[model samples]
Target: MNQVLTQKPHDMLAATLSNEMAAVNTLIQTRMASEHAPRIPEVTAHLVEAGGKRLRPMLTLATARLCGYSGDNHVKLAATVEFIHTATLLHDDVVDESGQRRGRPTANLLWDNKSSVLVGDYLFARSFQLMVETGSLRVLDILANASATIAEGEVLQMTAASDLATDEAIYLQVVRGKTAALFSAATQAGGVIAGAPETQVDALFAYGDALGVAFQIADDLLDYQGDSTATGKNVGDDFRERKLTLPVIKAVAQATAEERAFWMRTIEKGRQDEGDLNHALALMDKYDTLSATRRDAMEWVTKAQDALTALPNDPIRQMLHDLADYVVARLA
Candidate 1:
């Protein structure tokens, strides 16, 4: 994707967001390069150099700046969050057996799984050390709890995948675990580091949680209908992998006997050597699973906007508020 063209946004705020994201690229690069470990930079850079939105770090920096933070600690906090995120991607690639990420081979694909695992661990340790430098036990507490939640969420996803019995409640819990926890931590840490009032901190966290939920929901919906170029992953990866996402769960909620059997055969039984992909797509369309999931994502986008109403009405905060809306708009 052309990074320069990202400046084209329907709303002016998105333009600024594009620039803010670009501004953090260097900070991310410098922090990921380590002088000590011989291969640490290579592994860490493998993940970091692969372009992510850097959304987590941007959230930290934008929140701190929006809240009138004058000190430079937010930079450290932002870099810390990026490190944590990169670590998760390394571990996640190994767990998912993913060959491609950001259109490049995954760390586990380029090197051995052992190397990816070890590098991920080292990044985690480096993140902890970075947090300690801030001297804010509160920040550590928030991130430590977030780290645990992220791990538990990943475990939940692993266990839940291919489990036909998975329901809406379980899906939401999994989403919170896998995506919302880090988003909440990133924004909450911003407020905590910036010394924002507790109420504002709470508001930022609530906003982030809702935004993350909507983002994940959109992702689930797109797995069924998104352009492969835009999303980078294949259309049926989630389905083929047997992970029951929101769309499938919603469809399953109202599935008939044959549709249920179809799901069982394709998703659970893994008997998809035949043309099950077409059958699964037809079933998803018949049930309007894509539409239903998209609606859920939109609802959360509204809820996310509502959460931001309590924040001070400033350009930055309002942009963030708009950002929540922007996240799901593309999927629409």
Candidate 2:
């Protein structure tokens, strides 16, 4: 299997998994509807139709097919993965007070916070219903635990967001809880549905976990370096938001007393003014925190690629391998 570094990784996966993805899409539409409330579908469609990459669900379909799964259950599982992801986005927008998502108005902004929160809950319930239809307790356990971990991670971030005391370890804990939990569960449940060997299933979980970490690190790094037109975000959005991501965490660890005061004034007290973003970038550059963050992201990418060696050597596996690299490649 030749590794493809030229193409978009998920696009390649989508081409290969087109049929399965269609089924997942149909299932998502069917399950997202509420007969009593037209408002439910309207709110759900606003976000669902917003053109976000369906990466999480695609991982489930890819892993299941890679493991030679032939059952229709993977379709249900893929939709379940999507529902969980959509639900999270709804709640996160409300929590983050985000006005925009994927370059469009967020559901909370379009409708209301109450609509966003309740629709998120509705999707969550739909997810469980879809998962239960699979009749695999192990699958249910993985997805259920992932849901809990994501909620816990969000809570942890709330406490750790502005605190300078947040170290890389705590940051990783939050990432694992909020992001990697679903990624791991998506791949793990896919393998479980295929009845793959225990080792392969564990490997799938590990791959998803590492990939999720790298994916998030790259996203945080982008907040500092990405083109606003391309990312649909201004540079240092996270800084203005006062979220203590890895680059800032690294910079804080190496901050001088004067630099510490700057971080405290801007990040801790939320008293940012003109030139603060530039100063934050300067300090991060002085400590080489962006490079340090990139290094950590690449390490996770390596971990993700290494995990793939445990699975069958095939086209899907190769695509997964490239997907790991492509995640961090955005930083370059």
Candidate 3:
């Protein structure tokens, strides 16, 4: 068998789109520079140059190309998508008080919270400028709504964190807002910029939404049972953070009266002790919530694959389909 054939779907997609991705990187570097405020570039470079997968922006580039876009505007949109993502990451690190990102000290940790916030604001302004340059009202509208939705989702997650009442429906809402909104916007804007038909645009939106949901759910699942090395965090990190992810939600929903008190003490009140993580995992195992969460992630994967049926039968499309499968392949 060819070695390339055995590579992961995203790695393959990255290789296939290497030239375009290089262009996106160049554009990102160009736009992230600062003429007046050197700290803007310094803060931005700390996070942007970090070795992230760049999966979100790549979605924009791949979707535009899959829709037969041959214009340079897609490049701008790809950079816009990345700027928005990085800005959110900077803000998120502040909110989460995270010390590390991509296995390095977070920008907020290296600099200060003030610099991260201001630099993130600068990036958001830059993203809007890039989108406006495209001169497409619909593209602007899509990205603008996504930006608002991202903020709203973060607020929702903050308010809902550790609340026992936070169920699967609320979880889905948060996921759509924080993760899927940008994803759908990235793909939908790509199709719109390419002047793809309405049906194809809708399909692209659906594909991105489902893929984002699947990706997030898989990430949540991995937080419980994944390898510390591969996942870049110790297992049960979510439990420690008091996050009511799907598995914990499922377990909470099925908790006995005694189990409810346990959740109330540890999750709602944040009085976790040394054995709390083990107890939480035991509860999830007792209710088989991990398997249930995996099932939910797989359903989104199926929805994503179904949505791709409406797209063009290009090689990029096949990679996208495989990408959906790869998101949850770890859980398998």
Q: Alpha carbon lDDT of residue 58, candidate 2?
A: 96
Ranking of models by lDDT: 2, 3, 1
Residues forming the 10-long window of minimal summed lDDT in candidate 2:
1-10
Off by over 4 Å in 3: 1-5
TM-score of each: 0.92, 0.98, 0.97
lDDT of 3 by residue, 213-299 (tens): 999999999999998778777788888888899999999899999999999999999999999899999999999999999999999
Clashes of 1: 0
* Local accuracy by lDDT, each model: 0.81, 0.92, 0.91
lDDT of 1 by residue, 95-212 (tens): 9999988878998989989988999998888788888988999999999999999999899999987899999999998999888888989988888898988888998899888888
Q: What TM-score would candidate 1 get against the native?
A: 0.92
What digit string (tens of lDDT, one per residue) describes model 2 on residues 103-206?
88899988999999999999999999999999999999999889889999999999899999999999999999878999999999999999999999999999
Task: Give the clashing pairs for model 1.
Answer: none
**Residue-level lDDT for 251 in candidate 3:** 94
Instruction: Quote the lDDT for 228 in model 3.
Output: 79
